[model samples]
Target: MARALLPLALVGAFLLVAPPFLDLGWQNALINILIASLFALAFNLLAGQAGLLSFGHAAYFGVGAFAALHLMARIEDGLGFPTPLLPLAGAAAGLLIGLVAGFFATMRSGVYFALVTLAIAELFHSLAPHWQGVFGGEAGLSSMRMPWGGLIFGSLIEVYYLTLAWVALSILLLWGLTRTPFGRLALALRDNEQRVRFLGYNAHVTKVIIFAISAMFSGVAGALQAISNETANYVLFASGVSAQVVLYTFVGGATIFFGPAVGAVIFTLFAYLVSDLTRSWLLYQGLIFVLVMLYAPNGLGGLIHQHLRHRGQLDWPRLARPYAQATLGSLLVASAAIFLIETLAVVFSRDYAVARRDAGGGFPTYEVFGLDWTPLSPVPWLLPLALFTAGLWLVLQARHPIGALWQRVRAGSEPGVNPS
Candidate 1:
């Protein structure tokens, strides 16, 4: 606990103080990060806690958004409610909808359950556009955040603080949930529903409660999002939104409490920083997810957790060299892939094709990262191949040392074990 406090304080201080210093775009990105982090954690409650994989969690998120917007609309019409409490509408709506949805969805487990959730989200997406009265048609719902208590939320800074407070509170509440008896039951359900049922718990009801609670928080995230954007749309219910949360949770390490938040922050920042640099940003993001899933099956958080768990027994001095080698090797491979992908992206672009046509159908010189290269030339293409080869060799060389180091660590940690 003492070891955790310093880092947590630093992070909290940074979050509270950094927004004002950041540029408008960065401040806005920070807001999105906060919202995404909450969404990821909320989704993790269902996925990691109860071992329930929901593909339509976005339904609750979208419902929450629309609900908040509706409240805001009413407030605009002189409803006298405090602006900051608007997300409660979203929370209530999400809980109600989640209960109804979970009642039916939890009847089946595994893939069937996932499909039902997906179908529910799809239903929302399909119906939202046509249900103009509530959803405001295809344009969706829009609302203005009214002034309250001498604080106007017109600036990004105000919105950032609002989001930060809500997210921090929500995360703290979720973390507290893990310390309760019900939290242990959720884990038990995750491990074996039949065993939990044998232990005299209603498995279906347990699942439904977990689902609704997860959805409630998800709605809070959505409400925060609506607050930031001042609007809600059918797009909020799209499968992509649901899929993104899954990717965030699993890629961040679902087993770890804060894993999803880590993934959300990294991916959101990646998008904010990299998306403008290339049209292939989504491809890069997908590739990253694939690589993380393949190499660190438990997610990046799992790697950190493993190191921390074995810190006392592990010989860091012996591990450092191989770890450094692995790091460099991975970087080399990633750089090579980036080079190849970017080069190919530029070469295959419509502008490049037009240039080829104008040049009498010959492969012409194209710029990638400000350097011009002709596709006919082998020199530029050799760089990625060289990088890839070196990277593969280095990673292979490090593998043996890494394995040996871990083996020694494992052996050393055993009771009464002696190491020479």
Candidate 2:
């Protein structure tokens, strides 16, 4: 109970401290962090605990968003209740969709399971653009103020708080689920499907229940997004968004309860920061995903776990040199790649216009460091490009040395190094 209560205390502390210190921009970012954490937790319900990879979780999100939009519209028209009652409409819609989807999807497992979910999402995505009455025919749906206790939802801050409340509730519920019998059964199914069946349990039913729960949580996220933003678009059902949620869940370490939450915060913040600075933010995202997949399948959480396990038991001296060498080489390689890309972009765009009006002038007029500064001539770009390539080559060469050290450690040749 103490362990369970710790996060609540931390949350209370954060809420007390954060608002006074944060500007509007940071407050908005905090809201986004909460939203993403909810979304990641929803995805992790099945992906992490049940070992089910879903590619169409956005279907529920779309449904919930539309439901919330409709409910808000009704409330505005005096056909529905106050603002607080609106989430129920969204939850009901989510539950209905989850039940239907779960029935069909639980028949398959592994890759086929994901494909089924994707197909459901794709079906909805296709219909959303053409189904005029139900989905608003590509124009999507709109939401309005709920007249909360005769108070109006006028500020972004209020919306942020509303989202925070919902997110807090959702996280609490999911955490509870993780400690329940159903959660244990879901993990059991993940480890040994045949064994679960041998115990006279209907594994399919267990899967369906977990999937529905996951879908419902995802729906809540979608509903929050729609209501908070005051709009819902077909883009909410897109495969790419689903893929990103999966990526977020995996990158945070699905094994631990808080792993997805951490992943969501980091991923969303990183994306926001990178996108603000560069047009090629997607490239960076892809790079991070690939590197994480290769180097840390269990993600940041897994790495932390490993470190904690070995920290006091192992000799610090033997590990320090190789770890430093690997870390520095990795940073150099990333820097070199980014430098080369910017250099090429500058050199290749020969007739690029420098808008001095936007930059406040005197700057070289290329885009870097969130400011306009670029190479005046192709030669400048070429020089840096060549230098970066050399740096990259040198960095790549260090990989060999790192690998040799890792191999020695792995082979049990290193004294005081714990392989386990």
What is the C-alpha lDDT profile of model 1 across 109-151, one tens digit per residue? 9999999999999999999999989899899999999999998
Worst-scoring 10-residue span by lDDT in model 1: 411-420
Worst 10 residues of 2 by lDDT: 350-359
In candidate 2, how many Å is residue 318 off? 5.9
Per-candidate clashes come to 1, 2
Query: What TM-score should be assigned to candidate 2?
Result: 0.83
Q: How accurate is candidate 1 locally (lDDT)?
A: 0.93
RMSD of 1: 1.2
Question: lDDT of each model, Cα atoms only?
Answer: 0.93, 0.78
